[model samples]
Target: SGMLITGVTTLLLSLLVLALAWWASIRGAQMRSSLPPGPTPLGLLGNLLQLEFGGLDRALMKVAQTLSRNWGPIFTVWLGPRPAVVLCGYAALRDALVLQADTFSGRGAMPVFQRFTRGNGIVFSNGPRWRTLRNFALGTLKEFGMGTRSIEEHIMEEAACLLGEFQATNGTPLDPQRLLDNAVSNVICSAVFGKRYGYEDPEFLRLLELFNDNFRIMSSRWGEVYNIFPSLLDWLPGPHHQIFQNFEELRTFISEQIQQHQETRKFGEPHDFIDCFLDQMDKVLAPQDPESHFQEETLVMTTHNLFFGGTETTSTTLLCLTDSCPAQVQAELDAVVGRARAPCLEDRVRLPYTNAVLHEIQRFISVLPLGLPRALTRDTHLRSHFLPKGTMVIPLLVSAHRDPTQFKDPDCFNPTNFLDERGEFQSNEAFMPFAPGKRMCLGAGLARSEIFLFLTAILQKFHLLPVESPSNIDLTPQCTGLGNVPPAFQLRLMAR
Candidate 1:
């Protein structure tokens, strides 16, 4: 009797397992039918197997480019079980993000950030919260002189300090990573915290390391896996947990700054971003309105977004300049602005070749290639496909940067890509390094100014002598996921 009961139980369990698998297949099929078509996904894994986990950003671009040939420009790919609509080539991206901006401006779930942020910050939050914080941030940043001549002065001051540091190296080959990080970070710090740290300050160095480590890990395969399976990865041991720990340390630092500001700040007088936010909070937070978004946590997260965004991307771009030293740009700099003064924003118009070189650097490296993921605000028709509200969208920014139709020989680092027949700097509609639409990077103006000022300032004073021959210097990124991390290289800065 016992033997017979065991057999019957085993048979029932098998039947139940098979039934569940069948149901999942049917459900997945229904979801796919509603979305645009791509390579058929396997059970549970979706299209994950098709991607190269180590360099997810490049792999996605390659896969999309190949699949688009058969699947059209607007097609779907399964990131785990979630379906994301990818906008390939310049036309597809422009049509969706520009022509129909509002409909495609919603923020999507990025499990890595979602876990820590919980939808509280400006970058990840959707709906009213995002709008309120974004508007407030824009106003506050402007007041701090983000896009004005005042901010340019701050950047120029920082650049002078940076040149001193490089000169201190005495033309020895050294990695400019940390020094560049410090210079770029100080610019944002002056606005956000109303102060700057010495380059060798231990505490400041520790904080920058946290930022660097988090960016690198988040741009590795470990980050890709965590985003795909956050719950499972939480139980497993890995380097990804370091990301949260770093976030906690960063949050603690920001909170401490907020506390100090609260103790020192006056009611009507504001000195920096933290002071402005505190002033706003005092006016807005009421007992009747318990769900106000201007709480302390929001302040920390928004400040974190500004600090991190302001520092990492710009610094990485500066570091990559080590690999590129076009003589024509230097010649333009020498002719237009002599060594008597430093390069300024006004110099960009006068030095067309130098301006073109900077544009080409951004276009060639294509940092943040995948960009922050976007979602649909409402049910909308894109091309021939009907995408319901809240559908995930992935804009392949690198695709547009490398779009052959928009740029000639897009793969190479040629300044002529941004120059016209008359050798004048000509702007292309597809030159969107910061992405596009309403949700585009708020710091775009500030970032562009920094890249132009810092690069020209450095080149004007020092000659970047790469350790290896220019032809042999590799421009391939160390990793490509959250951002394209330039490979590790050292260069000597000889005083010109």
Candidate 2:
């Protein structure tokens, strides 16, 4: 018993010594390189306490604002002993992301997602694997009608279904989020699975609910804690476990879809994104070839990436816009679209107010505010600070959108930010809701089409009436770490 106790004590002491060595090494790295300065970190915990106040969404933006005043737009905050160089404001973001695109193109490690993907997928991968998968996925998505009018027609069709669902609400108070999610998800389903599921399909509903629930948990404070102390949380009991369960379910669903595609696929005649990918996999595979990115696992992860990306942000943006500025948007839709036919992408040019409103909604809410973390591909100089290779970067996209120098009223929800002197739909470099540069969202075009068509179709068919007074509604998100998920509220969809 005495010898056993001695052995355990020896192991504990060794671990403590190793931890000290690691902490010392991190401090050494900070001292060796001229990293931008911020509040001093507390040993291992870092500035988690400071950045985790209220909600990470608001806290991170606030921290950047406060630090930028002293440290300029580029500054550093230690996220559990690992320092992250945050790029705040429009100029800083543009200079680094746009100017030095290649150097800052690496995908940073996000523990929450890394656990699920294991760095296998495009979203959280870097270098050759990422490049190969991303290019293939982009080409396939485009061939399957992502940016062109072919995809636009698909969005419009989904919009019609969404309108029907809203019409069936019978003008009673109802939460439109699930209906919006189904419509938005079906757009990606068309591209990936080559078929859209009905709103009442059990499998489709379960997948949507899984994505929604995972997003909610990830954006909560618990998610933030897990990211910071993953090793500790992995052993402890918590809500973070649910994120893995959700990922497993999504993986299973995607695997099933892939198997279905493999069995029924016609060679060379690609029906959809999955069919195209399978063809690529077959072409790349050889008896002697050892390395390949086009495997069944890659297909599954990429498909999930597409589905998750396509569903969440666009639907949340639509939900926020409808909940906040419904009356005014409906006014614009009525004046421009008139209730006769569905609104199309071409109509976007004529409806400057509606276009401007959509842009402003994305700006005000800043969905995925921090964006997926990026990594420095190589040691580089930025804004007079030395950022090292593999340094995690937070673009702080919310900061860019709300930069006071760029916008007239940065805080409030005003559509004029995207309008010119003549009230035309004007573009701004500062407006980077889909982010900017080499790693910009692959589904930007699809998301834009979905948001515009779905929103206009709903507005054309019915008027959005808030269950509570607009003034009483809280614009602050329910949880805000990874993504800014809006608070739950019902709306009365009165038929025009």
Candidate 3:
């Protein structure tokens, strides 16, 4: 009789706890009825089971289409129990990201980046840290020739070197990935490290290859899974582990650079961003302020952030642009600039077709479909949803790029999208390849300059021919999620 009484009492306590939890859930849901509408989610798992099969970009689009029909332009989706409010279509994204900028300026937690950076760098930090780093970086970069003619000289020099490499190929088919990587990486290396590496330098090649491998995996399905369910996937062994390894290797490389700068850097006369940062560190470290973000680890991560951002996306876009419509680009180059001198930024206005083609390429690719997730800094009302502080927000960039209201034939790749009926370059408010508002890509100016200079220089010297027939060439990306990575193909740089 004593044993039966004890068991009955324990069971009653358990039942009481479950009843309380159920009551709390119901109460919370009732309180948040004004929150954006979404499909009812299973506990803890949320919508992961529904999103497992297709690319996250496509799946999200489908969800947006289905939910927006009932919930309107802005709706909620539970990414593993955490509710993320997505801004679909052009108007919704522009309103949240541009109009209410400060409230939505907080950077969301990107698991892959957070694991590596630990909230240190400009790319993935929030609040005061983000403002400090971003301002310092912009000011320092401007001093070092970002968005200036001084920077164009650096890019043109790299372009000349790249031209030599292509000339060396002797009309044979070559994989342009490594060559393009070397050229683009050199431009950023000049700004960050105060020097550029030789194309054949083993150490530089290894670092570039590491970045490439990480980018490939990061865009793969495994990378998407890691982003959505980091805690669950952390223990499970997979290619995601390689991403961590690559990050460590990159960290080591950056550490070596910082150590060398610390030992050799001269005061009052800084050469690059690292030197400027060291100068700032000297001033700030004297006070030993607890809130100061000038630590050595921050330096390493920021350098990696700049280098990684500067290299991959620009090079990948060049490859895709050249592969997609080489003949037309070359024809424009021949007509306008001729094959006499390397193309410069000043000529960008003169060559309307070339400018339009580059713009079209950026629009067509939509490299970062889901712009970096943002967070609410405070409790805010956005598009009828009463969102709590720290709610994750996604600005669906692809929706803007593909909005029918903004461009004619949004799905098709046509240079005319960026051209007027008179055949001059035209700008579109919805053509936000670099995104818009305060959080727009800092390197946008540099990237546009690089793409223009390098492609025109190459076109001036040689014709970019594909290994396969033009009819057989496909422009679909190999992976599509956070970023759309263009498919790899060899090109014959036949001398013109």
Instruction: For residues 196-272, write the lDDT of model 2, one tens digit per residue.
Output: 89999999999999999988998887787888778889999988899999999899999999899889989998888
Candidate 2 C-alpha error for residue 377, in Å: 0.9
- Judge candidate 1 against the unseen true structure and give its global Cα lDDT, from 0 to 1: 0.87
Instruction: Give me the runs in candidate 2 sitting further than 4 Å from their true place.
Output: 1-32, 146-149, 322-325
Across residues 71-169, which tens digit of lDDT does each residue of candidate 3 receive? 887887767656678888889888888888888888898898899999888888888998999999999999889522399999999999999999999
> Using lDDT as the measure, which candidate wins?
1
By summed lDDT, which 10 consecutive residues of candidate 1 come out lowest?
Answer: 318-327
TM-score of each: 0.95, 0.94, 0.92
| Tens-digit lDDT string for candidate 1 (55-126) | 766777787777677888888878776778888888999999999999988988899889878998889999
Pairs that collide in candidate 3 are none
Order of models, best TM-score first: 1, 2, 3
Tell how far residue 137 is off in model 2, in angstroms.
Answer: 1.4
**Pairs of colliding residues, candidate 2:** none
